[model samples]
Target: MKILDRYILKSFITTFATVFIILFFIFILQGVWLFIAELAGKDLGVWLVIKFLLFYSPKMIPLVLPLSILLASIMTFGSFAENYEFAAMKSSGISLGRAMRGLTIFIISLSIVAFIFANNVIPKAEYKFVNLRKNIIQRQPAMAIAAGQFNAIGDDFNIKVNKKDGEKGEQLTGVTIHKRKKGEEYATIIKAERGLLTSSESSNLLQLELFDGYYYEELKTKNVRDEKKMPFAKSTFSKQIMNIDLSMLNKNNMDEEQISQTNSMLNISELNYTLDSLQNSYTKETQSIHDNIVKRTTNTLSREISTSERDLSNLEKERDTLKKDKNNLLSLLTTSKKQRILDIATNNTTSNITIIKNSKAAQNERMKNINNHWLAFFEKFVIAYACILMFFIGAPLGAIIRKGGIGLPIVFAVIIFIIFHFINTFGKKLAQENGIPPFLGSWMSSFVLTPLAILLTYRATNDIGMINMDSIIHQITKPFQKLFKLKSNEE
Candidate 1:
């Protein structure tokens, strides 16, 4: 390799390494801040905390790599242009494209590496990170209950404690438990002055022994009139013992539902498999809902529904028949029979409406989950392309701007990155809400920035200013120039 290419590559690598490390650390700190609640006051040791952060750090790569490359590109090239090194190279006939050859190859390789890391490393890291959180709760059940907050235990209980002491944080003070029963809200409440937790590893139940406590339970009566009195039972106890099940939290067994449920923990192949099952399930559920509606509204359409085999077009056609013979269809029926039919129709319609309202929410949620999987699938490529995109933009923009050393470069990088990030976020949100296709949502940022990169590269290659202000000024004054010329001619 020529000295110039080596020099350029060396400069960019040094700058990229420096910028990436700093930005990565900053983002990791941001992650730490975001989840500080889970880490702080849990009594997790320094080693465990460090391990947690280490597992989490890889997830920041998609954000950090592109921005770091952009900043580094701009800084290195801007420094080169500012110092007249580009001029020296241009004098020797080393075109900008030629100068970028080595770095371009390096960038292509880097983007591939980034994609691999995203597809492979990121998923594994996410799995570990999530499992670590659960493992902490598993090994130390007390860690699951944070002080000063109502920690929910499964679907049945919400327990809160003002303070927790002892080596394993088993001793509790000012404890409150809200027990949930079907068809009731805050149905049972247990409060204690002090409590102690004891759990057996072999058993899933964690025993809570409370002292100086009171128990209050809302009583329900089968008689509707008596229920209005709002009867409740209250009692005081010097010592109380309750067992809480921690099976799901500590089972160390994989739930098939949970395994298929998480998008972040799956690789591209796994995502494809999961998405297929999800789409099929969504379709089946949707058709099932339509069948239920059909069953409710029209007994005659049962044959049509069964024959159509998931197709509802024939049932829709029957709607027009009812509309066309609206009066004739009821004319042959007896008056009492007609009234009974009308009453049944009204009840069926109300039931169908309720079913539709409930099913709509479920369908939307299912569709959103599918969209998320697609988003995750496309995001890997988008981030990989972003590395190349940012390089094109930053390297050319740096040369055009002709300023160096993180002064103007930092400002430009930040503004451009913010725009990219905002557009990306907007697209993802829109896709999540089913406003747009997930493919488009994932690539929205790249699409918006690609043209800018092309324009910048074109300008830098031809040695044109970032903006042709002189041409704009001349055009703005052209009419006046012509007017003055006419006046001079008349004079």
Candidate 2:
């Protein structure tokens, strides 16, 4: 029995490793396909690209692990059943349950490891991956700017070019540059027939050398009377050089605290803390909204009372005097005054409505972020459970199908994984939009697969094959066979 357990465990481990590698490779290729635009023609170093991919691999583990487990389990169990190893074991009084006992323990352990990875390892990896991409983008800012597009540099310059050339993108043609200072209406525009871009790794300055260009400057006077005659200056030059600062752009330097605030970069406890803070903020914002509405409504309806001391008779006289004053004010109001009052009322109403709408929009955005944090919080556990559930499903399915190798098992595993992926993606989207409860949305895929896993396991344990299509086909063709025999006899 110990030997049997070891054999099965060894087989599963080998298959799991193979399947995981293949799946991991495929997912890496897919990621490459998705981000080739960012990577291509950049001349990034081999080590740099490798480091980027390495940082990115941890994020793919949650997506890849369950599929690999499903494929490996199916292939392993299917090969055993197809080769009649299960039958041989049963004949020797070893039940199917005994064969699965060792593998089940291994799978549960894998699930725990996966959970730990999601909690501890993946968040850090995600943080690194994001920062790596940011560094790459910052290192090659010229690659990000396309030809014939206005690319703003820092706060003071906008650069554009009609054509760019060379592998390193060192050559440029038909360059247009605009320079301006803060709070200035006029700008200095430079148009060149050709240009060259160069930068150094140690310095934060980007230098552009231009040839056969003209510089045009628009000067404005501070006086309003002189603005009608704005002065302009133009000069042609054979060659010129300009230095632009690149220090302000987000570089490789990032505060870990600020980046960790993102949901993807936070663990369960961090997410819960963030969620509590967001909920408090949300509550305070809502209370502020209520207070504003009540305050505005009260202010709109209330009128100031005159400070005075009076008895009952004095109060009656005062009321009569106020009524007379109101009548006199109404009489004094002109048509323009009435129109102005109506306009003021309209404007105030419009302002209040706009404020309410903006408040609701802000609240909705905050709620979406809250939902995202909750989803991330639940996702770690869900994916861990997914690994265990997928194994149960694949192992039982493989036994029932009795098909070995990658052929039928691959098809079944892919189909199940697609369903799982779709359900999970759709549920997350629905949860983000508040269409479903965050808990339900996060666990929807697991909820769906659990029952299917149970049913397949039950059928496999009872030695029942699911819906024999061969028997159904034979039954359908039997009537045709009898009709053909009757026709032949008559002939």
Candidate 3:
């Protein structure tokens, strides 16, 4: 490497390291504050909290890198400007572009690092962080039994302990277990002289060993005729062990549905597969809708034809039967002069025919509505690529911002990212419920941001210039008064 290149690279590395350390400490402090908040009402060890923060650090790198770069750049340039190093370089026949060549190389390298973090490290860390939270929440039951407080482990299990000894690895005095199960309550109150917890891997059990304690177990059995109760008492001979299946206490183990999600721990390939599956789902949904439409249409027409035939048959039967009845009535009428009976028979035939026509019209209208819904379902499949589009938009935006610091940049990024995120989310909902074009709704953020990024980058690069803020502000404000005719109109 050239001497200038080496020099510039060294400055950038030092500045970046300084900025990273500063930002990292800030982030760690924030994490600590959050950890403290989480620990406020709980019995958790400080080391365990620190361990969680350490595990979570890698996930912050992606957010931190960009912000670090921005701050580092500002500091690096500001230092050079302050020392007149830039001026000296310019006077020594080195152009600004030439001096910046090494910085550009450094920026490109950082960009690659950022990309790697975003693509690989961040995803894994995120997965781990989520799992860690689940693990902590699940394991907290074991940790919750502190000195001098009543702690509830699960839905119906309560425990209290008085002094805990570090050397003996046991708790002393005041142990209570209140267990309730399925409309039955059982309380085991113990004033143990000493207590200790022991676990066995083979049996997957956590045993609470209490020494010198009076024990009581209340059992109630439901009966159709009468209820029964049993009481037990124990004075410590040597030891009393209460066996609990620790695996059952492990909430993480029971939540299999949570583990089944692709979003939880998926790699890029898995994400791609999920996206493909969603696409395939939409495809199948569309095909099913089309198939349903065709089947429904054919069934409706067939049913209509059958109904008409049945109606005609009924009408003919009615007419034939009525004619017979009328003939009978006529014979009766001739015999007895009964004109009212003949008039009532004619009215009944007309009413039956009118009912059949109305039923057929209603069936036709329902079939039309079904066909329209099927057509709408087919249209939604085209917009499924919006997820991929939004990702591209977000990734490029991180680069364009140039300020890699997580403070404001991260806030901005998240705000922008979430806005895009929610837009896509709401768009999907709209598409599902209101028959909106899923594609337009889903890709709206990407479409809006792509042009905005391009325009900003163009202005930042060629014309307006990102660093030349004063000049750009002056230019804008100078034209604003003239365009608005404020000063000229006053004159």
lDDT for each residue of candidate 3 in 1-491, tens digit (9 for 90 to 100): 78877886787678778868978989877777876645554555677666578667875664455555545554454455446665687678775456556766556555555555545665566566666656654554455565567766555566777666654334546666655555665565555677786654344466788776765565445663333333444444357787665575554541222434334244445555665665566557556655765565466444433323235665665666667577542332232223443443455446545644664465444433332333223222212222223223332333233333334344654565566556656665665443565445545555666665555435433324344434655787987867779767877
Local accuracy of candidate 2 as per-residue lDDT tens digits, 270-384: 8889999999999999999989977885675332222232356756666766686765443334566557666766776888899999999999999999999999999999878
TM-score of each: 0.83, 0.81, 0.52
Which pairs clash in the backbone of model 2? Answer: none
Candidate 3 pairs with clashing backbones: 66-404, 66-405, 67-404, 67-405, 68-405
What is candidate 2's CA lDDT for residue 206? 86
Winner on TM-score between 1 and 3 is: 1
Q: How close is candidate 2 to the true structure, as a TM-score?
A: 0.81
- Considering every candidate listed, which one attains the maximal TM-score? 1
What's the residue-level lDDT of 9 in candidate 2? 94
Q: Per-residue lDDT tens digits of candidate 1, residues 10-69?
A: 999999999999999899999999999889888888988987998899999999999999
C-alpha lDDT (0 to 100) for residue 29 of candidate 1: 90
Q: How many pairs of residues collide in model 3?
A: 5
TM-score: the better of candidates 2 and 3? 2
Give the lowest summed-lDDT range of ten residues in model 2. Answer: 301-310
Off by over 4 Å in 3: 37-51, 91-95, 129-141, 144-163, 166-169, 172-178, 182-196, 209-241, 249-264, 278-313, 317-491
Q: What TM-score number comes out for model 1?
A: 0.83
Badly placed stretches (over 4 Å) of model 2 are 139-169, 173-191, 214-236, 250-260, 304-348, 469-491
